[model samples]
Target: SSLIGYGRGDVRNTVGNIPMEWYQDYPHIGYDLDGKKIFKPIRNKDELDEFLDKMENPDYWRTVHDKTTASDIRLSDEQVDLVHRLQKGQFGDASFNEYEIHSCSSGPIVEKKKILIPFSVSKMVHAIKMGWIKPRKPKETTPQYYDLWAKEDPNAILGRHKMHVPAPKMRLPGHEESYNPPPEYLLTEEERLAWEQQDPEDRKLPFLPQKHSCLRAVPAFSRFIHERFERCLDLYLCPRQRKMRVNVNPEDLIPKLPKPKDLQPFPTTMSLVYRGHTSLVRSISASPTGQWLVSGSDDCTVRFWEVNTGRCLKTLEVGGAVKGVAWNPNPAVCLVAVCFESTVLLLNPALGDRLVVGATDQLITSYEPPEEDKEQAVTWALSEGPEHDKGHRLTLTHPKGVKQVVWHGKGDYLSSVMPDNTSNLQVLIHQVSKRRTQNPFRKNKGLVQCVSFHPLRPYFFVATQRCVRVYNLIKQELTKKLTANCKWISSMAIHPGGDNLICGSYDCRLAWFDLDLSTKPYKMLRHHKKALRGVAYHKHYPLFASGADDGSVIVCHGMVYNDLLQNPLIVPVKVLRGHQITHDLGVLDVTFHPTQPWVFSSGADATIRLFT
Candidate 1:
C-alpha cells in the first residue's frame, strides 16, 4: 500500500486508489490536488552509481522508499528502535510497558468494577435484622369476576340510547304469496326454472307462488328460515340514519294578513246600473268631482249620466263604435274625450258649472294652426257644419283607427293609441288647448296594448305586449322600462302618487310595479278566473280594483309606504258581481271616482254598473 502526504511544497495526488503501472508510459505520474500534472523526477543514476551510493551511504539500511512521493525517506534512531520492538512482538510506544500493574494513587478505582462492590453486603443484612431499614406493606384487595357476554344495564350506561333509530318494518306479503292465489299469479315451468337459476339478489320473489287446487295441498314455505336469517343479517350489518321530522301547522305556512272586515271602505256591492246602450259598453269615465259619469259603447252611442241618480241626461249617436272614453282629470275642466274609428271627439259634457264647461269648450276650440304648419301623423280639425250641434266641438283624425285615448292630468294634453302595423303612427300626443298633435315615438316597439299619463310628472307610460316603457316627454328619451311578467298587457293605471303602477294582462294576471324599486314587477296577482280587461286606482283612497271577463270586479286594498326599505301591502277585500257575461265579453272597462272609493265597471251586457 502507498501513502500520500500534504506538505509545504507538494500536495497529495488526487488520483484515487489504483495501480501506478497505468501511468508508466506518461511523463507525468498523476494530477495534484489543484488538478495540475505531477511530473516524474529526472533519474540520471545508472546501476553502477546506485550500487556506489548504496555502499557509501551509512543510513542505507534505515532508508524506506515512499511510493507516493517517488523518494527515499531515512528513519531516525528512535524510529528504527520502534520498528525493531514492533518486529519483536512488543508495544508500539516505547514508554508503555506491557507487564505493568495498574493502580490509582488518589483512591481505589471505582468505575466499571463489576466484580467488587463498594459497600459490604453483610452490613446491609445486619441493618435489616436490626429493623433499621423498612419495606413497604402490600395493599389488601378483594377480587371480583363478571360474565363476558352479559347484557349491559341500559340505565347504568351513560347516554347509551341517544339518537337511536328503530329498525324498519318488513313489507307485508301480497295476494300473490297466498297459498291459493289466482291462476295468473301461478308461474310457468320455464319461469320457475329461470327463477331457480338466477342470483338470489336478482330474483323478484323469495319463493315462487303456486296456485294450490285445495288448501290442504299447500306445503310449508321452503325459504322461510333462510329469509329470516337474511333479515337478521340486514338488521345487524346495514347502517341506519336517524331522521328528525319537523311538525308544522298548515295554517302557519300562510302569510299573515289583515282581515277584510278591518280593511273596509272599499266598494263592496252594486249601487246603480246605467242601462241604455244596446251593445257592449267598451269604456267609461267619471268626472273629477264624482258627480257625473259618461260611457261609450259599441252601439255607436255615448251617454252622459248623473252618477248618483243613474239618469242618462244626454246621448250622442256616433257614426262608429266607441272604443274608449276619458274625462279630464283636472277638476277645473269639464271635458270628455271619446275614441271611435279613426277620430277622437272632444266633447263638453256641459253638466257641471256652466262657466267651467264654457271655458273648457273655448279652450279646446281656440287654437288655429299656422298655414305654413307641416302635415303630421294626426290631423286636427273642428267639428264642421251639422256635426257642430251634437256636442262634438273638436275631432282628432288619425291615419288609422284609434283603439284608446287617455288625457293628461292637466287636461291640456291627451294621448291616443292606434295599433296600426303598416306605419309608425301608433301613439300620438295631442294638446287640446293648442289644437296641435305630435307623435311621441319614432317607431313602434310592439302592438300598443294601452297608454297612460303619469298623474304628477311629465312621464308617459306606453305599454306594449310584455313591458311598459316610461318616457320623459321633456327629455325626449326613454326613462325606464318595466317588465310586466305576464302575457299580453290589456290595460294600465298609475297611482295618483306617481311612484307605483299596475298593469292588467290577458293572461288573467295583474302586475304591480314600483317605479323606484326595480324594472321588474314587485308583485304579481292572479285572482281573476278570466283575462283582466281593465284596472283602476282610486285617487284619494288606498284602494284599487280590477275588472275581468268573468263579470266580476275585485277590489283590493293597496297601501304604499313612504319608506324605501318597505314594500307595498296588498290585500284582496271584495268581489262585486252583478253584470252578466255576454258573447264571451264580461267587463270591458273599469274606472274609479276621482275622490271616492267608488268603482264603475262597463260590461258587455250593455249596462254600466257602479259599486260604492
Candidate 2:
C-alpha cells in the first residue's frame, strides 16, 4: 500500500475551519514540523479556542519563522561568544606531540575546533519562543468559523455545508471479572446426585461393569469416557429428560411387521388376570412347564398361582419384601430364586406349601397418636430376627440389600446387584453348590443398570451408565469390555443365540448391539415415551419385547439371520397399552411365554395381564 500525501494541509488549518461537531468523531488530526500526518488532541472547546486565538496573530507567525531558522545553530551564550573568538583566529595548542602518539594505526587523536556564525542567535530564538517579544498585530480579519459572508457564498468549500449526523465514538465492551461457585454448591437434591456422578469414585459400578479400580485410578478420565458416550448419543445422563433431539437417518425407522393370524388373536384379548398381591407387584417369572406363574410383591410375600386359573395356590411369608423373582432354567433343579432386602432365598416351589419360618423383628412397637392432633404412621421396615433354617430354602446374605437377582443358564450360580453399596462389593454371586456369596469388585465402577449371564458361555455381562463389561466366571477376570456407543442402560436382554444384545435406556432409547459387529450398537431406536424398565427375548419365537414406565410394551419380530446376503430384520409387531400407572409407576417387569406367542405384563396397578 502507498501513503496518501495531504501536502501542507493540517488540523491546525483545516479542523477549526470545519463544523464543530466533526471534532466529536475526528479524534485528533494535525501535521508534524516536517509536514507529516500527526495527532494533536485539542482536549476540549476551551483549548481549541485558545490555540486558534494565538495562531491567528501575525506575531506568532513571525516567531515560528525565526524559531525554525535558528533551530540548526542552537547554542548557549558562552558557546556563541567562543565561536566569535574563534572567528577572530584564537587557538589552544598548534604544536603536535608526535612522541606521545603510540602509532598512527592504533587510533586517531581527536581535537576540538570552534565553528563560526554570522550573528549570535541564542538570545533571539529563546526570547521569541518565551513570548518576551510581543506579536505585531496585522490587518484585522474575521475568524473563518464565524465568517458569515464566506459561509453564505456558494463558491466556498464549507459554504454548502451538509447537515449529517456525526458518528459515535469507537469503543469495545468487556465483561467484569467475578468468581463462579462450584457445581456442588449450586445443586439441589436431584442435581446433587448427577453432580456427584461426574466422579467415578462417587458412582457404583457393580459386577465389573467398567473395571472400577483402573477407572477410579483416574476419576477425570472415567467420567470423560462416560460423559462423551452419552453426549454422542444425545441421551440425558441426568434423571430428567433433556429437550435436545437426537440425529436420525431413514434407516432408523422401526419397520412395521405384518400381523400373523395366530399371534393376532393372542394380542387382541387379555386371557387371564392374576390378582393376589395386596400391594404393587414388582417381579414375575413364568414356569418352564408353563403350569405356574410365580410373583413377588411389595407386600412382603411370594405367591405361586396356577397358569390356567387366576388362583393363588400357595403364599409364603418371607420377612423382607421380595424385590426380584427368577425361575431356574434347569428342569432337574426346578428352583425359584427370590430376592429379599438382604438375602437371596432359593426355594423349590413344588417341595411343599408351607410358610417360611423366621423370628419376626417387631416392625412397629406401638402406634401412639397425639391426644388432640392424632397423627398415625405405620412402619414397613424389614424384620431382622434370629435365623431359622428351612429345609427347602437356600439363603445368601447381602449386607446392603439387593435390587435385582439374575440366574445363570443352568441355574447353578446367580448374580445379584446391591443398590445401597456405593463403594465396594455391590455385585454378589451366589453359587448353589458352594452355598455362599462372592463379590467381584473392591470399588464400584458406576451405577449398576442391569446384569445377565451369557446364554452359552461361562461369562456374564454387567451394564452400567455408559459401558458393558463381560467377565469370565471360571477365570474370575474381565474378558471383554464394550466401550458402548450408547447412553445410560436401564435394562438389557441377550438373544438366546448369544449373538445379539439389546439395551434400553431411561431416556426412552433402545439399542441393539451385535457381538460379532462391533462394541457400538448396530441399531438405535427411540419409540417409547418414558424410561425403560424391562426387556425380554422369547425363547421359542423370533421376537423381542420392551416394557417401560409409560405403561406400554412393544413387541418386535427381531429375527437374526446368519446368511451374508440377508440382513437381520426388526419389525415392531404391536404396542400393547393396557397397564395403567399408579403412584406415578407403570409396568415394573415383563416376560414372554416360552412356547406361545404370549406376553405377560405386570404393573403397579396390582394386576397381571396375560396376552395370549
Candidate 3:
C-alpha cells in the first residue's frame, strides 16, 4: 500500500508494522518493515519454559515474568516440538541444556538476570561455574530440597544438645570471714590468746632507744653494764679474796702547751721632710742629681727645694695654673720644665733663667710673625730662609691650655701635649738644637692624657681614652698598640728596670703590665679610693708612688721579686694626707730622687712634701 499523509489517527497504516519511533525506544526487540515493535523474537522457547517452570515451582514466576506474557499466547505444536527437542538434546544428540542454548542464542540474558535479581543470579552463576549446579544424580536429592527438610525442627534439635555450665561457687572455710575482718576487732582470738601467753614483764616490752639517744647514754650504760657483768661473772671476785691487791689504772691525758706569745708590737714613726706652700700644689719632680726638688702648683709658680735641708731655694712665677713640673738630670744646674695653663716654661732655678716656648694668644701682647725668618721658623723648617719656609710657628691658642710638657732625659728633645677638645692632638716635638729641627707629633684620635718616653729607649708611649700607642722614634713608626682595661688612662709610668709598665686609670686601679708580654697585666694595685692621676717609680728602690683624686699620696714599697700571695710587698707604706691643706683636692704629680730613697709628691693642696 502506498501510505502517505498519515496523522495521529492513522491506524490503517501502522496495523501490522512496528512504528519507527517505538522501535527507536526498544531497539533490541525485532521491528517490522515500518521500524515499529511487532514482536520480541524468542530464539529458545524451551529455555524460557524451563526457567519459567523453575520459577513457578518456587512461586517466584508471578513476581518475575507474569507482567510480560500470559500462557494464553501459546506456541504452535511445531514450535513446542522444536522446544522439546532443544531441551532434551534431540536436535543434535549433543549434551547441551536449555539454559546453555538460551545463554548462547541471547546476547546476554545472564547480564539481564544480574541487573534484575543480582543476589540470586550471582549465587546461581557461581554454583554453575563451580560444577555445583549439575544434573542431579539418580539416588541423590537436591541441596535445596534437603535444606528445606532439615529446617523442620531446628529449635528442638538445639534444645536436645547439652549446654555449657558455669563453675560452682567455692566456699573457703575461714578465708571468707578473714578476707573482710571486723574493724572494731582487728586481731583474731587465737592471736590475742598467743599475745596474752607471753610473760607480763616481757609484754611490757623494754623501750628500745633511738640511735642518737643510745649514743647520748652510752657512757653511763657502759659503766653500769661493766659493773654488773663483772659482779655476775666473779672470775676475779673480791680484792680481799686475792693474796695481793690489784690496781686498775686509767689512761693518762697529756696537757696542751699554751700558745706562744704574739710578736711584740714595733713602734713606727714617719718623717715628713719638706712642705712649704699655702695653696694647692699640682706637680713635683726631683733633679737628676737627687739634690734639688721642683714643685708646681695652682699658685701659678714653681718652687725649688733642697733635698736634705727641706728648704725652699727658688720661686719662679710661671704665669697661669701650673699643672706639671719635670726636672732635668743635670746636677750642677737644676733645669725645671713647668706646664702652665697656656704656656710651657723651661727654667733654670739656680741661674734664675727661663725659656718660655708654647704661648697662647690670650697670654701674648701681640700675635705677630717673627720678623727674622730664622726666629719665625719654629717647627719643621728645612732651611733658615724666610722665602723657603711656608709653615707658621705653632702658637698654643687653647682656652683650657697646655696640660703637660715633658722633657726628654737627654735634654735634646721636648714634647708638649695639649688638649683642645678637637680631632688634632696638640703635640709639639722640638729638637733643642741651635737650629731647631722641630716636628709636630700629631696623630692621636682622642685627647692625649699622658705621655712618657722609655727611660733609656727612643720609644715613647702615649695614653689616650682607650689604648696606649708606643711610637718608635728610631723606626719612625707606631710599634705597638695596647688595650688599657681602664677607659680613661690618666697616668702611666715605666719601671726603673724598663721591663714593667704601670698605668693608673679613672677606675681607681693601678695596673702593671710587663712590656715583654702584652696579655693580661702582671699585677693590679687597687689602693686608690678615687681616680689615680699620677704614678712615679722610684729611681733606686723597688718602690712606686701613686697620687689619686682622693687628696692622698700613697708610697708603695717593695714591688720587687715578691708574690702577693706568699710575700705581699707592693702595698702602701705611707699615705700623705692632703685634706688637712684643702677640702676638694687631687695630687698631680709625684717623683723619687734618682739616688736617694726619698719621695716628692705634689697635689692640689698647693704644697709639696718630701718623704723618706
Candidate 4:
C-alpha cells in the first residue's frame, strides 16, 4: 500500500542525501557491499581532496544526476559529479592500473539522516507549540449578523448614519404660488363677463349642470313657463271644457280585479343522505324510485346500497377497472352498466350475473333486410358474397378504448365517448339505437375528455382540451361553447336541473357557468392540488363532487347560482384519501347516485372506492 519510501544512511559528508553508488565490504560508504572491495578509507587530506575533486566536476555530476533525476530522486552536487565522471570517457590502461576507485572510497562513515514523518495529532500539537503554526480566531460579525443580533436584544442602542431628509415643501418652477392665481382673484370681472356671455351649449362647467344655475337657467326657465301656461290654461279652460256624460251606473263601471298571486319561498338547505360503500367510491347510480343506490369503484367491484341505511347491500366484482356504473331507469330489474377499459358490461345486480354488452374485439353490427324479395332470396342463397354472412358475427366496434358510456335517462339512446387510438386528443361519439343516427352534435376537434347529458335539457355537454361545448340534441348544433382561456377541461358535469354546467380543468380549478353564458366561469372552486379527473353533481342537493390526481375527492356545495357574473358559493363538504395517488395513479372518474348521496371514484391504483 505504501507508494514512496525514505530512510537514513551513513556518509561523512553531506551535500544532500541521495543515492550515489552501491557499496561493498564492512564500513563501506560509496562502494558496492558484499563484494571484494574492502574499506581502504581516505588516508589523508590529499586523498579526500582527490575524491572531492572527482565528485565536483560538472560533467561527472550530470551522469549521477541523470540516474537519480530520471527515477524521480533528489541528488547532491558532489555525489552527482562522482557518478557522472565514472560513467564518462573510456577508462585508460594507466588509470585502471593506478587505482581502484571503489576500494579507496569505501570507509566507516557515520552520518545522521532525516526521515519523512507522518502527520498525526501529536505532530500537529508539536508544530503548534513550536510556533510553526498559528491559530485563527473567528471573524467579527457582519452587518447582517449584527442586525440579527440587534433584533434579538430588542433594547440595544444602535447608531444610525445621519441621513438628510429633504424639506417637504420644495417649490418647483411651475408649482410656485407666485405665478398661480389666488383663490379670490382666479376669476376677473372681464373673465366672468366673457364666461357668462358664452353660449350655454358651448360652455364647459366645472360642476354638473344641475348643481349650479349658470348652465341650468334655460331648463329652469322652460319649466317655469310651462308651469305658468299650464296654470293659466287650466283656469281659462275649466269653465268651457266639454264634460262626458256617464253612460252606465258606478257599479257597472267598476270591473273586478284579479287577485295577487302568493309567493313561495325556496328551501334554504337540503338534507344530504350519505349511503354507499365504506371505502373509496368511484361511480354511483340511483334506482328509478330514487330509493336504492349502486356504486362502482377501483375496488374492482360494484356495490348496491340502501339510500336511507347507508348500508352496503351487495358487492359484485367486475374483474377490471370500474370506470362508470349506472342503474337502469327500470326499478324492477335494476340493471347496472359497468364500463371497463376495453369492455362494458350490463349487470343484473339482482341476479349477480353480468353480460358483456360490448368489448374491444366486438364490433357494432347493423342489420338490414334485403331491398327486394329476389334480393333477399339471393342474399339468403349466396354463400360467399360481401353481404352473405350476416348472422352472429363478432365485429370490432371501438378501435380506441371506451372511457365512458351513458344511457339517456329514458333509455332512448346509449352514448359512449371513446378515445381515438390514432389520437387520444380526439374522441368518437357512438350512439346505439335501432336506427343509428349520426350524432347531430358534431364530433369535437379537440380531445373530448368527458361527456354528460343534461338531466332535463335536450343538450349534452362535452369537455374538450380548451373549451366545453353544449350540443343541442333537438337542434343538432353546438348551442354554446365555454372557452377557458387555454385551460384544459379535464371533466364536466351538468346541474340536476340542466341550467348550469360545472367543469374541472388541468389548472387545478373547478369552474361552473350558466348554460347560456360561457365567457367566464361564474364560480371557481379552487381546492384541488392537481388536475381534476371527474366531477359529479348531486341529484337532490346543491352539492357536487370532484376527484383529482391528489387521491382526494372534494365535495363543493351551492354551485347552482354560478354564472359568469356571480361567484358560486362553493365549500368543501368532504374529502376522501387513501392511496399514494401518484401522477399515473390519479383518480380517473367520479359519479354520484341520483337518488342517494353516495360518491364513487376510480383511480389509477386499479382500485375503486365508494364514499358516503
* Candidate that would win on TM-score: 1
Better of 2 and 3 by TM-score: 2
Mind sharing the TM-score for model 4?
0.43
Off by over 4 Å in 3: 1-270, 273-276, 351-400, 423-425, 435-437, 440-442, 558-583
Could you report the Cα RMSD, in angstroms, for every candidate shown? Answer: 30.3, 28.1, 35.9, 41.0
Displacement of the residue 78 alpha carbon in candidate 1, Å: 93
RMSD of 2: 28.1
Give candidate 1's TM-score.
Answer: 0.62
Note the Cα lDDT for every prediction shown: 0.86, 0.67, 0.60, 0.55
Per-residue lDDT of candidate 2, residues 1-612 (tens digit): 111222355222332233433333344443345565444343344777758857785344222211111111234445455556667776423354534624445333322111222134666777889999778889888864533344445666445664233458774421211123333334366754665566766553211222223433534444788778878666655666658688888776946556654344335457888887887888999877677788999998888887777788878878778889998776555578888887777765653222211211111123322354221111112223332223234556556678898888876787888764355666767656534445676666887867999989887898888888888878988877776566667788889988888888888888888787778777887878888888899887888888888999888878788774565687676788888888878888889887788888888898788877
* Candidate 1 ranges with C-alpha deviation above 4 Å: 1-247
| lDDT tens per residue, model 3, 340-414 | 775555454543222322221112223333435344223322212432122112222333467787877676566
TM-score of each: 0.62, 0.51, 0.48, 0.43
In terms of lDDT, the best-performing candidate is 1
Candidate 4 lDDT over residue span 518-604, tens digit each: 556766778889888788787777778788888787765654554456644555555667544654447767766555565655666
Candidate 1 lDDT by residue in tens digits, 1-612: 345233477556767777777677678878877889878788677999889889999888998865554566687787789889989999989899776657655354534343354356667878889999888899898885444333455652222433343558997677788989888788899999999999999998887887778889887877899999879877986796546599999999988999999988988878898999999999999888889899999999999999989999999998799999999888888888999999898887678798898887777666678875537677777886677767778877888899999988888889999997677889999887777788778898888979998888889999999999999989999999999989799999999899999999999999999999999999999999999999999888999999999999999999998898989999999989999999998998898888778899999999999888
Sort the predicted structures by TM-score, highest score first: 1, 2, 3, 4
Which regions of candidate 4 deviate over 4 angstroms? 1-320, 329-333, 351-397, 421-443, 559-568, 572-588, 596-612
The better-scoring model by TM-score among 2 and 4 is 2
The local lDDT score (0 to 100) that residue 505 gets in candidate 3 is 89
